[model samples]
Target chain A: MITRLSWVSLLVIMASFRFTVDPSFYPSARSATQAPKEGLAYVAGLYVGTGVNKPDFIATVDVDPGSPTYSKIISRLELPNTGDELHHFGWNACSSVLCPNGKPSLERRYLIVPGLRSSRIYVVDTKPDPRRPTLAKTIEADRVVGRAGYTRLHTVYCGPDAIYVSALGDAKGEGPGGIVVLDHYSLDVLGRWEVDRGDQYFAYDFWWNLPNEVMVTSEWGVPNTIEGGLKPEHLRDGYGNKLHFWDMRRRKHLSCITLGDDYRMALELRPFHDPTKLMGYANMVVSIRDLSSSIWLWFQEDGKWAAEKVLEIPAQPLESGLPEILKPFKAVPPLVTDIDLSLDDRFLYVSLWGIGEVRQYDVSDPFRPRLTGKVELGGIYHRMRHPSGAELTGGPQMLEVSRDGGRLYVTNSLYSSWDNQFYPEGIRGWMVKLDVGSGGGLSVDERFLVDFEDARAHQVRLQGGDASSDSYCFP
Target chain B: MIYEALSALIGVFAGVDPSRGWLYAAYYRTFRGDKWFSASLVVVVLSTTTTTLLTVAPALIALRTHFYTGFLLLAYGVNTLIHGALKAAYPRAHYSGPLKPKLTHLAIWSTINSTLSGYGLPLGALTLIQAGSQPYFYLAYVPVVTALATASLFRGVAHARSLTLNYDLILSALYVAVGAYSILYSLSTILR
Candidate 1:
């Protein structure tokens, strides 16, 4: 008879199918259906709890493809900052890539997350080991006028040849904002560039495609004068919400393509279900500057910008008719923070912070995102947390699905102190591990707890309290 | 070092992390050998009781503008004394971590993180809550909140075991100075 130890070794060797990692917005496909296991759900996430006493930023990587393990953390790293968790891992490789020359490749090799106020970048150099990373550099924020006041660090992209960082303008930069180009290898400051006269340049949300062009979604920071974060009733609050293409080689702003009509919250320059081709998606594209609604900013290249309004993230479908329950969140936009396409591009994965759910759609054809499978991951959003404190609730922020299109990972509780001031203290912030396979369509295999009891994870908008908690209700 | 830090951070979040939930729970069973959740309950009860009591206490209600103003000044003076000591000791001492910071290594993780990150709304809420409370409550909330934040801020340092006596010694000196400033401030605002 075969021994039990032999069985374990064989089991470990046969890892299950997996999902994408490193990046939050873009879910890339892996070469294998599973990581060699039957229960492997390759998706995972890290949640940092700076607000709580036991504020341990956790790392939960789901290896089981069948019954996904939730609340999984390989370590207990105390992440800095009491507000806002880091977003989007910086890399191209799934497990730190080693170049053919035996050198380290940044793709999945490591991750770069900005310490917003530090005016510095916190890079976890995972090239040393796939599971554990080393700090590569602590690059300083750009110094303007000898004082780097609010040069908040947003997004970091390490391209095949160069690395680019976008900086939000001083609370009062006339145009959109600015972009800082750096040498990918040396991390040297290449040059500082700004947006066009009428463009509203926002930071953090931008996409860099192959060969030449880089697209940045306009938050319309300037022109619209969006210095403070997004607020309702701001008629002129639409800048960088549009897609601004910059020619990296030439180092100048090329053209600005409006996103049909939606406030550009974030943008991803990832493949459209295929490794070879890359497409752009801009979500939180709302007209009233609300969080709901989005216009997919698709581009494989050519000349014209192929934009489509895939979904109308209704305000609050269930309570649309009930005013008392839906008053505060009324004008509040439906929060469709991040979206992804399956490896075949036949399915779409969208994470809704306000609703706190990750949805799967059949996108076999371009321009249309047909709803398919769905799983509500007790989100990290306080605004949407079942007021009665029910178990089946959530505040899902960013999300990604596995390669074979099985597992999913979603984070809730974005924003920090600023959010506390704005949002109600209802949500228990944390990461929700979703196991997505079909037993019964899109399912919820588990709900891992990421929040500390005292410092619960709630949406920043809920910091203000009850009145502002439930206004979102739309069709 | 970065990945190590990240992995460590993730480690803390994983389970063995002492700062948050595991330690107290562990101390209850493994170390203190108390009942499950008992150790945590004690702290929770005490803190909650203290916070609730301070909410309506008379000592804090009166401190609003004048008393807090004095305390801020006193705290500033205490800060100067400690700043002078730090300058004398290291002169140019700067740190990131290691020799394995244990848990507390996070104390000086960064100046940017310490002074700013996520301090806004909570601080504002504290301010507003202090305003709503009676005079005695003011005394309780102010120092209590500061002490709690301080304890939370410094919790990792003591347990890390990697920190030197010098770190503790410096912390002691600063604690005393801040204590004097805080006590004076809290006591001054007391109604009777």
Candidate 2:
């Protein structure tokens, strides 16, 4: 007769081989909102503007209020190479692991960090000890280019079966940027994701509604235009102003919506967290006509996709303290670099990088956004000091909301070259947390401020799952 | 005989890719224990074999010639190139929608593939006869073909039960390898 312990061991071994999905993988956005609060947040720390020659790193900060190391940098997993210019990174496996037909037995333990400028990818294993993540693998630039025929890697999203990465340009760093896929387990570059690219060329950000089988990809300029920093001529003639929709299941570009030539650089897409909802928000970074930024709602209409401008923030006219890039305009353009939707889809956070303000809008009714709260810190003219009397340099750029939508973490750096052009004084990278009110309000957490002395900070991801980190298959 | 065998192998791969292979495996898994479906599958296979032997074999034998052999090889190469190009251009041609729609597509595609590649076996036998080749030389392929087909079908069934194995990737690799091999061999035979 087999002992009870032996039987238990056998069952455990069998379970390991059963390919169980991660417990953190939520089935619906609503279910994710009820997940336990994340204790640590990962922020991309870059040493681009600083005189330091050290490589960019992913900083792990303790966010648990009860911990003695709360709001402290617990650890920093530095990349092996310098000039990586780490922009946005994500978990290797997300809620999508639970998706129907999605690969199983995969754990959400690796962070897929991509160097926007270097075009290199790092697989950081956040296992055994989440705080002390080690570099597991580094996929070189040539391999990525050879596999996907793309460069200037951007956003990373964990799909059902593969880790999807978006690139800003082709092999020569030219037009017609697209997505590259990697195997979930090995982290090996699979190939380009598009089957029929259609007329879409420029690519920056992408998000999808899985059950609806719809994926929306936004656009920014190619490497030639963006790497050298923004130019007025390029903004007029070169930057992308269209949003492409795709059949996610078929991997075919179905249609596109031109936000018009006036609205240039249509970047950053925040789809509804609910899988059943077919609508999402797309932010146009800058309008050449008025120097203002606008957000639009894209939804299915009459069996086709359509987008309508929902909210517009006018440029604040500044008489003095203008950067050279904006001196001719004589006004601060509300460059909405990034936006994040709460897990419950009740709130939308928009980051105005130019004028240095992060606004919280009640998007319960996405058609009409009501401005509920706003926080001003850093800008071209007014470099508003934090409540702690610490001087802040760059305005809010990347935003990450907690799983419960109770806290919002904001990072200041946009892009390395863009940072130097906009804030000529150089961006002293910093990250701050805002305590979101129970109803609709925002307040700076006076006790929580992460000061990266010289390194510039970009995207922030919560310990477990953030509002934008994961997508759902069920309503 | 070798060219015909290679052509048949290419046909086997072209009939299904990663996506199509997975779909067929899923279909089998869905109706595995159903007596009616199993019976229908066996009947379909038998009917297809009977029809090809009775009609396609004699016609190919009557039309056999050295010049015709070269033409056939070139024709197969060109056909493969066009089919591959079309697949590359419109990858979404494969069914990904509902199962009901996919079943119809699978039936149509299966019929077309069989009709086009059906000449491979007969052509190979006729080519051997024309060359006055020994019977045992061509008969050697019987066990090899049977084992390959059986092993691949079994693997597909196992993969369908557990999604962990990426049988699709294996299928895709097999398709590319067989397609490239068939194309290169056809070109060399025609050129020589």
Candidate 3:
């Protein structure tokens, strides 16, 4: 009788296991918007300006203003090797797992961090103590190169079934860059994601609408052209000016819409948070024709996928203090390196990395984006200072919005090599918080500045699921 | 062969009480005269067979690839848990119905009844047969399903009603066990 009772008790315990899932996983974008403000932010700090061959580390900062260690780095997870150049890392499984066709029982616990320079991938377990994430497994560069046949990993986006990492080039650091699929659980490099190339080559950022079964991938130059920093000849000759659309489920390229050669280096892709919406925003970094940046809204028109240029930020003429790259142009281009949409899908934040400004637009109307607020901190010429009277080095590059859309975290590094070309004085990375008003505006928080003296800060991810971390199935 | 037989037997037993209740409603309460009795029985058999065929492709595809099979089983577990919770929350209502014998309504009701009575388990059993690459094993369900329909048609309405409450309690317990086991099995395969 005791043995039978023990078996029944054990069965009950096993049944309860199905209910176990990460609480951070929300079912809808609106649900994520209702989530509480995040208390911590994970910032990737690079050892570019420190003049040392030290490995880069991910720093966990306490963003909760009420906490004792608020505005402080609580813990750090350093990589094993140098020159990894950790750019954009993501959760292995996010709210995407809640998607209808999405895989269940996969927890959003591991952080998939890929090295842009090293071509390696590290799976960091954020469980037990999220503050101090520990490295669980590392896939060497040779394995990724051998399996995926691609190199120079750039963006890491967690899909419903697998972890998708977009590569910047082929094995030899050339054209035809594409995405590589990694197993969600094992972090194993599965293979190249693309079935048919279909003239789509240069890849930077890729995102999808799950319910609609459509994926949009934007492009930049390959490792060969990009690693040496933006060149005039490469800008004219090699940089990609097209946005490719794909059948996400079939892994087949559907169509390619070129934004014309005038608009070069279409870098970042931010699709609409709602899975049903077949529209998204992509940032074109610095048009060589006018040294201006433009944001294109790609959506389904009639039947075929199309794009319309919605907003443009022209270059600002500077009489003095121009970097060598900008001296010929005599203007600071609004190199909009990154753009993030609020979870509520109300406001769109543009990071003008070149002119030292972050612009907030009310994209409640996708086509007609009204510039609601703009703040300047660091530029090639102006070099604006913070409200706290502290000197700033680089302009806002990576933007991470809190789930509630009440606050925005801005980091000031683009790429280690590119940082040197733009900010010749060397970027002493710093992350600053901006207090967002209820309607639409930005104000710098005087007390919340994380000063990484020599380490250049790149992408910042919020503690739980952030606005950019997830894709939802429900409206 | 024994495994397939056991699976079919479980489906048959789980399906018996509801099938009998449906038969009682159609034969005695709703369609009392004419050829209505013959038509209602056909609807019951048709709906259950339709669901079985519809689910067979997904089950077969899942069997061929363990990745999808793991997720499919997990989905079944989650779906079962949800149904169990809903059942526990709202106890079964013993409705004699208005007994309006309309064809369209009969079709819908019979389909819903078949689904609720664990006809989906035939798809699970079919997946096992298909895994062994024996497509002919599916023929075994035809006679078994027909026998169940004919046997239930003769059951007295009083006896069908009397067995319901007890049958529901047993079914609820079965759901919990099946849901738990499905989740456990899928998790073991995927997480391992």
Candidate 4:
């Protein structure tokens, strides 16, 4: 007969094993089963301040492997407003969670696009045609302001019931914005996330490690201040100092940890896809006072979330072979803005917007990330010559990794106004696809480049895709 | 006069009083040792409560008569149905109302839906229950209902004219400014 205490001990041990031995822990064979779909068809890129009207639009590029018109613009869906400032967008449902009980399989359906400044959200139906997605619905910021009382929408993430958007400010563009929830199907405003507004500053990005039941969010300044331009005083005033942790299911604030004054303005957060890993990585933008940038690793220890500096990206020196125009600055700031983890949870990709380089790191060991490979493209002052011998204007900002962990896509522009401030030469619309080798190496695919020379590009989304910041893994 | 008194009462009872205890608990759990949390709680609770009481309570108090009251309740019940039907019937009517060509179709629907169902119905019921005398209750309901109808009519007209009043803009801007400043000040190092 097993005693009660012995039974309890056995249950605890079993639970630990269940969380530890997830599919992410095991390296499976690289085959079609690992891919979101059999073949990659199209890649949708967000173009802001592009075109005659300067209205932001979604441009779809056909990337079918055997297609005659591969790597060419197939469709364009433009927004009504001219200065909506299209930024980060997401999908209603992706190839994340598997359906249970004979339910339909999860596929890429509606694309949720939010205007960072205008506060408008457009829902595009990708099912009608993957290459030519139609505008299904639009949610104006005024309605969000009237209902959810938030504005300046930043990031959009599809949860189980609703599409969650992180707003920068209140309806009138105030500070410490909260998460606005919208119905997944109807695109109606459900309400704001039930987070008690207690010193929770501006919300920038959010990601979850579901198995650990923990969700983390980073912050930036209010929309009004940020839109005007990132002043040195904003950093001095401690705009993005703390990272908030919450109960993933309940959406309740759990705890917050400060990343110190030097690492203020924490931006993109990529939680490890393996729910059991309980680890995520976030990078801080360059502060005016300090040009250096660093990546902070957040993980669960003793049932609590703790963060530590994992890698420090030092500013490039004058002798670092940068363009002569960029050498005048004290140092070449890495400006590590965006980060994405591969579906297999084996590699981490960091986008250095300031210096124009995408560094690939091996994160099999979550605590210590080893830099495996890096590819330089464009920077603030130094322009990289594309394979076509044409000088590329902007740096790598937004990054998306393919489901099978074989292809990586990157866009150059961050925001129209910010692009002008940093890379004054301006963004000549462009996106590059990098082939990811099994050994964690990266090489550019010369033939697979999307060039919208007249349009400025922001974010990229693929059909039946999975991204580090967007997708969820089933237990 | 009644709107002001009732708004204040609800603001205190529904928002401040109940929120204090809940906020204290939240502060203890998530914001202990952070002074910004306490200060922000006070401002947010006070301002949001006041705004909610002002915008929603009057609309509810207006639905005094059985017809208006019944109509409002029915409208709330069938809102989802109406929304789905309208969306299906006129898919191209992107946005139409006083708010647009500035607002989208979904925005108008969200605003009207939230105003009537989330705010108006519940607050209207509260106003009716709180209005003790039958005659006084009916009197209170008349203006509230009239305001709602007038506002709805004006919404269409305003959209047609494409004219936005400075007063409304000022009020919204002021509310946002106060709320934003309060929240930002709370987060600033001075409060910390």
Candidate 5:
């Protein structure tokens, strides 16, 4: 028999463990002119930056923004691997005029999508309307390298009439890198670039410096084990982080940026995106692992980039009088994924795709980022672990900030099998929108929830591990 | 100058994980479910609690502490691995759903164990450098070592017969107590 006090304590314990995720901006069903009100389906599921198979699941959401309020599965922009699992999705400007302010030109909002399982690119044109949002035309993911074998696609973005993809050269000597380009309008394969042939170890990340110049950041040849520790040898034999610069005009590799020997955050090219160029040491936090997930500066003053490791974004924010923890439960938090920055360069949003949390930093100064805001997305009744029986994580992936700073978009989904294991509800994704109108403080817009309906297409609760963990959708 | 080439090589290499390690790790963590794992996980917790005043200090609050709170994760991870290995070998361990809360408890404990001193993680990725790497040559020791380790852990579970319902309740209570303690400890740490 439990005492009344003990029962009360038990209730408190259960209550604390039970997390409630509410969206403050649940866009009330407003008229088409009123922008998504509650129930108007936001984004279905987030494309955690797809590769080869589907590239990106990015499609146009054509809601009337004023009508029915609840967006129907009315129409979806069909992707190359339309029904397949896409790794992620990205958007770039249509033309220079659209990006007149130097923001990713939205003139022709380009979709960056690739099939991770299959080497293919997904270039899509999207028109956003509450009533009807979908792809204009479907373009085949042309061959980036001679053979897309082992190699795959991960991220895609658009630039002045051109689309750039972040791919890996998995095919031995064929290419350790690849970025296929296509004519935006014709969707025809313009040209393909591959350097370090068969370099299948190409990490996943890319960014465009200018209209015709793009930077590709990826893991060249380091092997990391999930639910495990790092490779001592790979750490020593590390193939430094690369920031390859490409000459879009000639569709060739122009130059590259190397961070000597350091793991780089798949990045977004902003003003101070260059680690070697200007000394724009603004206050910002770039967490490396759990111990440093809440960190400020990744580089400690290399005379070129940042000068000190001032800020910290640890897996657990308890140090700052906060009861937060990074993913993995033990050890340290891995790298923060789905990282993006606001166009104004004022806010930098990073998702702990591991322990469901998205933190916003005031990069008013890239070096010393002020911990502007943080949103903790929790509720893992059954903490997610890996198939091998390691770590628990429920990744809050990828963040995209609007140009005007009026809104911020975020997706909660799992990237790897470990994520699925940790958070079986991972496949059941959500695209959350935060109204930054409150300024630096990011608040959730609860009005609507973008439920990736296809998440549960299959069953078995995904066995809670890996891509093979057949859930209802792709079961 | 050469860093550019090196970066390219490393990026391409580390990006070939295929999410396999994560899958294996997840299975090992949640094997059949978390309930059973939570039971033994309680044993490990009680062992620690008996010795450390901190463990009994403020159960709930303590969960927020660094080293102390880790126990929750260790129990969970080790349980999953043990169960996964058992099921993989015997292939007849059937169970139903609605066993998440217990599984969560198991996950926390196992993570704690791994961080403390289990080669379970490293043994699983002796070759992995980052996440994805092409060709897949480096990480050979992971599967072999994990099989051996899980085999040994499975034998231990077999030795104990099977986890019981009463055991689950005790385990739950103990860990919850530990978490409460850890949260309080974290507050103190911050204040200090």
Candidate 6:
């Protein structure tokens, strides 16, 4: 029989072993100083200003390795309003000819940024000077609500005929939110695109496999209900349960199926680039009630859409077991918040917010996803160590893939209020770059990290983008 | 009318969320409140019970001396003991027909019939207190209680006839359902 002293000795030896182990292994790759295929990537940076709803502005970060001030902020475009939460934005025109409804010009001329809370959309002219982007026009919230009867503008995407904007609530902020349509070139309010307002209320994200004539997933619940802090009751009551399907050309509702009673709050619908492959992936953000955060694969069979949970991102247990200080909040997984597909439709990248890690998966076979690589960063439980010897606070939340599928940039902030609840250490404003190998392996780029220690930065967009805007209708 | 009023009163006291209330209402409208479905379901249950007894009785008698038979009986005894313990821990308010005193005492003791009736009686009581007598509550409770009472009576008759087949089958089915219900109930409570 082992005594207490023997157990203590065993514990001590294990702890020492863990401390001495090398955290990450570096594989052979090209030099970090090699030039990217897209030339100089002028990244459109959306950051929260100095104070509460005060300093929210869009800046440009020169991400090109060959540039003199590479990985440094080049220009700042300040917004007039303080409270406009500048979140997700998309380009007006893409360089690909396969882009839906085909624009007259393929220049990445305009960048459409949506104010998540304020309901305003800013149209920025990036063509004037890609580095120094200037705000051309602002689509006021009141004007959109007046015409379209929807509020809380969430995601902006360039569809075939017009730009589609997913909003969270109605004019009075009550949900069953719908999508709003706008003229691609003129920025004209074309009105709401909801078919019949059957059950879909909370709209978060939507993507289409244009050739398959289908759009797979859409989010549920309102911003106010979901963003009002992380309460267990609020999570169960406020999150959504259904994944809707729509006809691509007709812009009409076809079918929808509930994912699961427990798997709620479906976000980030990442559809594969191969239009013939009628399959896409979505991740669900659940609270402690369901700590096993999962990624679901939705596919079409004989023309109807159905989804099944493919993989669960497991929560990492505390090394020394649960400490006295963390006993109250209960154990939770690294919330899988965002998902992005590579341009070539080979690799899938997922962001874990609660635990700081970006997981990469090879999803060539949509049903069976094989884990390729994972890079741990700052999170609620584990604070990531920066190269400068500083411990970053929050984990990765939003992910953006490079056009060539060689690089990935991630920022760590979900929402203003929810960010504070999870990462109580306060938002450490920073974004990191990961080098993606051709075989779906990942390595953190030691030389290319954008540090914004003062203000909270989020959602990175490339100068002449590739993936988000382009849609291949014919494989 | 009085029972309906009392059920409504208990539901109000239970204070379930509005979402659950909607679920309860929908379940009531579809299953319990629909006379044709309820009647058909009762017939199906009775026919299935008769078919199971006729088929399984002779086989059990033939295998009476088998080693598997002794193992099954041992497993059943352990299941009964655990079920009794659960019933004792979570005591419920039981009804003894109409115009009878409500039994508030926890079931610390166990009988062969009570154990064979499965853990459904105690589980139903707990669900009644937590979700009240809402149709959603009855959706699981009514069928379970009915199955238990019918199975217990049939088990007794089967034992008297010296053919333990029906008794064995009913007890096994009860064991599976009870185990599943216990796990799901615990999960729901903890998660909530």
In order, the Cα lDDT scores of the candidates are 0.40, 0.73, 0.75, 0.59, 0.37, 0.58
- Candidate 5 on A365-437: residue-level lDDT in tens? 7666777776665424223332233332344565655434455566555443434444443455445556664
lDDT ranking, high to low = 3, 2, 4, 6, 1, 5
lDDT per residue (tens digit) for residues A161-264 in model 1: 34555555553344435655554444445655443434344555554443223444445344234334455445345444566666544546766665655455
Q: Between the candidate structures 2 and 4, which one is better when assessed by DockQ?
A: 2
> i-RMS values of the candidates, in order?
26.5, 14.3, 16.7, 26.5, 21.5, 29.8
Best by TM-score: 3
DockQ scores for all the models shown? 0.01, 0.02, 0.04, 0.01, 0.01, 0.00
Which prediction has more favorable lDDT, 4 or 5? 4
Poorest 10 consecutive residues by lDDT, candidate 2 chain A: A10-19
lDDT of 4 at A247: 70
TM per prediction: 0.52, 0.72, 0.74, 0.64, 0.47, 0.63
Candidate 6 lDDT, B1-192, residue by residue in tens: 433433232222111111111112222223234443234334433333233233223323324433223233324334533553443332221111111101111111111223233433323322322332343433232334344533343333213122112122222333333333334444444455
Candidate 4 lDDT over A1-475, as tens digits, reads: 2234433543443343211111221111122126443233333344444435556778887766678877777778876777777778887753222211000122357788888878888887776576777788888878988888888887877553356888888866667688888864477888888556556776888876543446688887777777865555666664676789987556688888877667667898887775546788888876555578888888778977789988888777655544433455646788888888887778999999888899999988877999998888878535576666767778988898877778888888887666766665567878887888889899888787778777777777766555543444332
Model 3 lDDT tens row, B114-169: 56644454345334434556543553464365447445644554343222123333
Comparing 3 and 5 on lDDT, the stronger one: 3
For B39-136, candidate 4 gives per-residue lDDT tens digits of: 43343333433343454444344544343343333333233234323433332222111111111332233334323222222234334434444434
**Candidate No. with top lDDT:** 3
Query: Which pairs, if any, clash in model 4?
Result: B60-B124, B62-B144, B62-B145, B94-B105, B95-B105, B98-B159
Q: What digit string (tens of lDDT, one per residue) describes model 5 on residues B6-32? A: 222222211111111112222233343
For candidate 6, lDDT tens digit of each residue in A1-475? 2234433543443343221101111000111112145533433334443345454777688787878888777878888887676778886644222221232223347788878878888888876577787889999998889888888888777664567888888876778788888876577677888766565667888877653557665775776685465566666767786788886556677778777777778888888776547788888876344476888888887766889998887766654323333346456476898889886777889998877889999987888889998988887666676655666667888888876788898887787767766665578677788899877788888877777766677788865564454554333
Off by over 4 Å in 6: A1-36, A39-53, A95-101, A318-329, B1-192
Span of 10 residues, lowest total lDDT, candidate 4 chain A: A97-106
Candidate 5's error at B175, in angstroms? 81
Model 4 TM:
0.64
**Location of the lowest summed lDDT over 10 successive residues in candidate 3 chain A:** A13-22
